[model samples]
Target: MNLANIQDFGAVNDDFTNNSVSIQKTIDYCAALGGGKVVIPAGKPYLSGPFNLKSNIELHLEHGAVLKAYPDESVYTKSAFRQNMGEGTIWIGGENLNQISITGGGTLDGNGIFFMGDELHDSYELKPFETIDPRPHILTLVSCKNVKMHGITVSNAAYWALHFIGCYDVSIANISIYNNIKVRNSDGIDLDHCQNVRISNCHIESGDDCICLKNRREYEELGPCKNIVIANCTLISTSCAIKIGSENMDAISHVTFNNCIITGSCRGIGIQNRDEGTVSDIIFSNIMVECKQFSEVWWGMAEPIYITAYPRASHDHKDAGWRLKPGAKEAGIGKVSNITFANIRCKSENGIFLGAASPDLLDNIRFNDIDLEVSKTTEYQGGYYDCRPCKDDDFVGEQTAGFYMINAQNVYISNTTVNWGTQKPAYYGNALYAENITPLILDNFNGTAAFEHLESIVKKGKTQLEKIAN
Candidate 1:
């Protein structure tokens, strides 16, 4: 591999004005010359559209170099596999490339705010909509291998900040992603059909899930996504801090999230395996969550570590839609199992809620060493109004349980603490409720005065008395 400086190769600086072909030509030249480093000089801003990469190439940016792209849709005339989805038409996809590294203390601005779709831009012109996806994303890597991206600031993505599709052996570190909340669908990073990836030491803030996982389609024959780890990250968003699909059916397994700090998000952590797909063997440990101001009344919209396999709009009896109806036989799309949430501490405007569907389809869930507190909301969020005073009675459910088991089984909660700052209102407050569930285990559960303790509450339940494990 060789090093090719953009300056040395006559790369245009501060002139995106008709300079789209210049950068692409440089990348092609480097690949043709058997790979090299394409350096962007310091203190200069360059402009180009959809710069593609090849084997053994490094796109290095100096301390102050900036790459700005034009927002004109026509300028990005490349095809789907080459051009941006719709935005200013930047980097389309990274496919079948190997040993690539994008490192720098520079900025890659999508100038995405301009193309944040017509509706969002008109509705909320003043607020930030960083997560809004006017296009596919600022960067998309597909079917690539052994890639490393570090120390770059990616902002104002028209869609997801970074998207990995069918890529393997990749590492993303020390990157900063910020999206304007007014921007719709501006997810921080999305991993779809990817494997063996690691994301750490990143700061992600967006309108949607900071880091999201997907399986493409329910029965698309797509590859399984596994062995990915996310750690040492910070997240704040309007959606789940970390979310796993409403579009899964393609099998996502062996993913882990550890040692992260989340604040001011709709849900601290979320795991949603809708009836369309299967997600198993996922783990969350050593995480801290601070709830901003939101309510999760509807199971579908709430976040904070949830896993639902409910039926979909297009689902039918033969296509896993049976799970949606109240008493239908469990569909066979797949199950969510072997998942664990340990050493998680959450203090929020409201208590935490964790639940899933019936047995024979979803099982093996555990919560250990969990500590949570439900704070009072100062304002309304998610269409609900929080009207509690300093000394009013607001209810507190068991920190470990939010709702009675709808049809869940094999659920275990231990070593948990739930501190309610206010008594539950007349509407919702049960320390823990288990309905239509069997073989549920509760151990070392503790709650404050707001809600009765877990052990005693269950002992007095109206259900049959059969405890498999204390």
Candidate 2:
């Protein structure tokens, strides 16, 4: 093994010494010798500025090693390779590489709290910065093939924790990410325009999405995000546990998430397509979820499963990140179809939501053997649905059903159970509510209204309802 140790290149074990140059020297030495393992040895904190990764090399940390980010503005700068990826540093960055990997059971500590602003007792807030907020993402590896990240710990990323863009043949497993729950956009893992990916056996707790998939406008040349699979993960988040998009400008399809446990989340599973994307052939099965509400500073309303497709206001957020060009030839309307959620057991403060801007935008969604229980456990606000980035009103204030489906077509539910808590509000009423659905099928559904005076089912507009008694 052509191994290069960071300490051999004059890297010191301390809290103050800058080890960025030494680490890069070690990586470069390994790459020059035809690719081998570069080891960050155990027993001390190696403080570092941002460093670049090389191809055909493995960066491994021995047990008990701590590689911490140096949080000084002067030490970090943008590279031509990292354009359009928000303000601040890419702490560990690589682009267009092959056979690169990061492993070993050590820690990469991103000192995220230094960039935070005054705490808003209600929810976390940040000081304004130019272009965007200035906090570093722990890792951003773009256009790399044959990537592997496993058996590592990434802690306290002020921005997205681990972001991979346009990568192929990736495997991420046996990893742990811990971010401050009050930090706003510190997503656990982000896969952008990548393909043939598999994530398994991970534990993540963050302030944002635990796992998110996207196809950003800035990287439209990478094409779609497809053939991805996730399994056996335990996630805790203040946002969605698994989210497809609010930033897709291309197709995201053929995704599967199964055998997961989600707890203490704001939204358990979500698909929020708000751009020119067609999201289809997605399946989520055999999962357990528990969620509750937080303050409105975050986007969720505690719905255990949320799926919505809508259009962003062209006039608004024109300068925002990941947005399709204002007048792209593709009709800016997003479409979602062929999604299935089966054998899900969820307990939440809100219901299952399927609201799209128009019926033509969503179709052919199915739910099977889902057990949903809506209970008021927190003192926070409830009885609303949030469909953001729209031209009209962003929220529905008086949602009154255990299952709220609006402007959808060909929906199917079988062997499902909906139960309301003993202490629910007045806005919580009907068991099922539908509007503008062409064909809705409920086979062996078991539920009733929250209150005796309210009807069990309420229908509006043209609809075809089929029911089989439980």
Candidate 3:
């Protein structure tokens, strides 16, 4: 491969000098020469502003090399393609490209603290523009195909660390990302409206969701995100560790998460369909989770597994001076069905929550060979379920259950076990609680209590419960 070194283009190793132009020149030179490797050598740190990547190019960094973003906001601008969800600038990005790769053992630092402003510690409300400054995402690939990212360490992102929007045939492996827990909106990796993606052997620690999948809001015409596989990853986050939806405008299907470890997260394995999308054929297996409640600054309530399908409100669409107009054709509410969670071992403060909004019901969900333990040693004891249109203001009373289901259909729990902590609070009562459900099946459900007590632990409201004979 042709080698284009940035050092040859007058890019200094000093961290102070802005290396944006030099790096861009090297990348352009490599692309002009029929695409090759643009190498950043080791020894010192190089600082730069936003730069675009080109097709058929490999941006390779040697060991001990650092490519850090320049902290000044004036050096960067919004992308011309306007492919991103938020107003955040793109630090290192590419659009409408093919066969691009980023492979390195070096570090890419965002210098996010410089842009986050002074009031960083406060629980900044999550309004569209009220929370923080217009910080940039570290790396974004938009509408690209045949992308590969591996063996890189990305840290301290101001917003989402790595975002892939409308990309296909992507493979990401052996990467590490560490964002501060105090940093808001610092999601680890977002796969938006992409297909045939495989992510494996990564370690991610972030303040927000660790790994998230979304159907693009602006590019709903691109279709759904499908055939994604994420395995052999270690994740730690204040928000959900693995999530699908929460911004889905189209279908998202055929996704799987396997052989993963999730720790210190507020939620694990969440599917939140808020728009008129259909999310189905999802699976999570052979996972271990250790989750606990965090302060009110975060959104989740330490639920080990939470799935919900709800209609999106107008206010939910209004973010960053942008509003998704209500569709004139009356799209039906979102649907979540054919989901399976098996071979999961979880220690959580909160329990599994399955909720569906009005006129829609969660369908055909299954949990098999799972073991869950609920601990009482948490700071937040609200014990309330967080469903759509039900904020903290609508909390009726304390909740007491290992599994809470509402407005669901054809849910099957087989070979699952629940363990309640000895110090059960007054709010803790049943092992299973169902409301407005139909055809809920329990097969070989074992708990710490006796079989009779465990059977009594099931509390139902307007639900047809079935205990399958083992």
Give the best candidate by TM-score.
2
Candidate 2: stretches off by over 4 Å: 79-88, 318-322, 326-331
Report clash pairs, candidate 2.
Answer: none
List, residue by residue over 1-470, the lDDT tens digit for candidate 3: 88998999989977689999999999999999889999988887899988899999999988888898896877767742265435577899998999999998888888877776445443333334442335778998988999999999999988889999899999999999998767788899999989999999999998889999987566666778999999999999988899887777788999999999999898888897766778999999999998887776676787899988765544433331222334432224578999999999998877788887641458999999989888766767657755432211323225756887778988899999888866676666567877777888899987643123344345556788888854
As a whole number from 0 to 100, the lDDT of residue 158 in candidate 1 is 59
Clashes of each: 25, 0, 0
lDDT of model 1, residue 375: 47
Tell me the whole-model lDDT of each prediction, alpha carbons only: 0.64, 0.86, 0.80
- When 1 and 3 are scored with lDDT, the better candidate is 3
Model 3 clash pairs are none
Worst 10 residues of 2 by lDDT: 313-322
Ranking by lDDT: 2, 3, 1
Cα lDDT tens digits, model 1, 98-139, are 988888988777666666544442122323324221353677
For candidate 2, the per-residue lDDT at 306 reads 91
Residue 232 error, candidate 1, Å: 1.0
